[model samples]
Each structure stands twice: as structure tokens, then as C-alpha cells.
Target: MPELYERIAERFGELILNCPPDRWEDPSPCPGWTAWDVVAHVISNHRRAIAGLDGSGYSAPGRGEDLPRAWDAASEAIKAALRDPVKARTLLGEEFGSMPFEEFVRRMACADTLIHGWDLARATGQDEGLDSEAVAVATEILLPEDRDIRMPQAFGAKVPSAADADARTRLLNFLGRQV
Candidate 1:
């Protein structure tokens, strides 16, 4: 079975693949970002993680490559990195502050993908439900570090949600997402 991060990436990839070509330019939940920008951001996140492994930064989509293909290339690279024992053990820098690559990828990358996956789905009028296990894991991992994640450059301020809201809703609300 695929690990949570891989599964989350795969789920996100499915959304990118199924998206109608015309919808690529549609504005997504992220203010001022298009559906294509969402994919590029996810790929950029992957490149950041990859940089920890080998100092390579974000590579924009090639002239012949669409967003989906670019996403596929990024997804495969990150998965391969995590699968390699040596690469998974590499240390992250900067915002991650020297955490092992696997831990950062599992918690941070996985959560990023999970939330952005919902953004894409919502923007494109697809199913917005997220994986229950991924949601639970994200809640468990992020809720404790609430203050750290609440900065304007990151998830920013929380949006209100009913106390009775489900796990996913609460996570979304906490991550500065209205839904």
C-alpha cells in the first residue's frame, strides 16, 4: 500500500488529471490563484522538499509539458526520494530547521497536499471530500503546533467553524480556509 504522503499526492494528482482543460484557468479557493497556479504551488512545495535532498530548486513546466505532466514529474521525484533510505534520512533546512526529510515530508508535505487537494477539487467542481485518515493525521500533526503555523506567511489566522463541525472542516478552518 502507498504511504499516506504518496496516497495524498496520488489523490491530488487524480484531481489534476481529471480536471477539464478549460478549468485550468479558473480561480481557486486561494485568493488570486488559478487552478494551474495551485498545481504549480504544489510542485514548488515538492521542489522545496527535493532541495533538501539535493539543492535543486523549483523547475517550471517545460514548453511541451502541461501542469498535469509537471505534477507527475514532481510526484514521482518526491516519492522516489522518500523511498530511498539515504535520501529520506537527509535533513531539512530553514523553516523546517533541520528535521529529517521523512518526518518533514510526512507531516508537512502530506498536509500541504491534503489541503491543496481539496482546493483543487472545490475550484474545479469535483468531490471535495478528503481522505479520512489523511485528515485525522493532519489534525493530529498540525493542531499541536498551532502557533507556529498561524503566521501570515504560512496558514495565517484561523477562520471560524462551528465546534460541532467534522474533523476535516475543523482542519480547514484552522488552516485559514473558509471551507
Candidate 2:
């Protein structure tokens, strides 16, 4: 039984590892973000969350850096933090309030990674299918914040989805992805 963040991050990481080098600069579903930019955003978010857990200062992944290497290093640090009971349970700040670092990562970071995985896939011509379980969990967690999610964030305004669309499609639409 993997943690939610682990399961979601696994899919995102797989996409990263398989991304074509030539496609790294290709535009993604995320406006203004290339495929490489999507990966960097995920890595940066992971570093921010774990920074709160372990006091490891946050820094954006540099464009000149090897993003895959940086991503792997951050992933290893995050895994170590998650395994430590004290750090995992420690409170991390958010706009609303504070929750355990594990909860924050599982809820917010998990969803971000899952969605960005889709963006990366769309950009690089890889499979766009998402982990069904991750999509379900993300839908449940994100649906309630529909308005806030639309407000000039990484996500755009909520886009309409077909009534018959599947959970993953609905989730993507709710997060403002046109599917």
C-alpha cells in the first residue's frame, strides 16, 4: 500500500524518465509552460513541501540544471522525510491553516503531480492516461475548491466537461484542463 503522494509521484516520475529529449521544450497543456517547465514545477513544489517538513530550504530547479537529476534528488529527500514519523506528522503551513506534512503532500502535492503528469504526457506525445485511483482521490479533494482552484493559479478557470465523462475527465475539466 503506497502513500497517496508516492503513488501519484510514481506516475509523474515515470513520465519524466520516459520523456523524449527533443520534446522537453514542447508546449504543454499548461499555458506558458513547456514539458520541461512542468517537470520543474513538480520538483519545485516537492522541495517546498519537504522544506517545511525538514527545514531544507526551498529553491527552484534551475533551467541549466539537469532536471531529471534534480528531480531524483528531491524525490529521495521527500521519501526519507515521509518515512520519518516525526517529520511526516509535523505541521506545515498553508493558506487555510496547517496540517501534517504528510497530509499536505498527499492532498495538494499529490494532485499537482498527478495533473502535471497529464500535461507532460500531452506535450511529449506519451500516453495521457492517468492513474485511476489518483484521479479519483484528486477529484474528491479538488472538487470542493472549484472556485479557488480557478483563481489565477497553476490551474485556469474550470472548463466544462461532458456529463458522461469519466472521473478522470471530470477532474481534469474541473481543474480547468480542456478535455
Residues 1-179, model 2: lDDT tens digits: 13766777777778898998899999999888899989998898888887777666889888898887888888777777889889878887774249887777777554788899899999999999987888887887887877766665567877788879998888888888887
Instruction: Return the top candidate by TM-score.
Output: 2
Go through the candidates in order and give each one's C-alpha lDDT: 0.82, 0.81
lDDT, residue 35, candidate 1 = 80
lDDT of 1 by residue, 60-124 (tens): 55435677777887888888988898888888787677888888887855478888899899889
Residue 141 of candidate 2: its Cα lDDT? 81
Which residue runs of candidate 1 sit more than 4 Å off their true CA positions?
A: 60-65
* Residue pairs in collision within model 2: none
TM-score of each: 0.89, 0.93
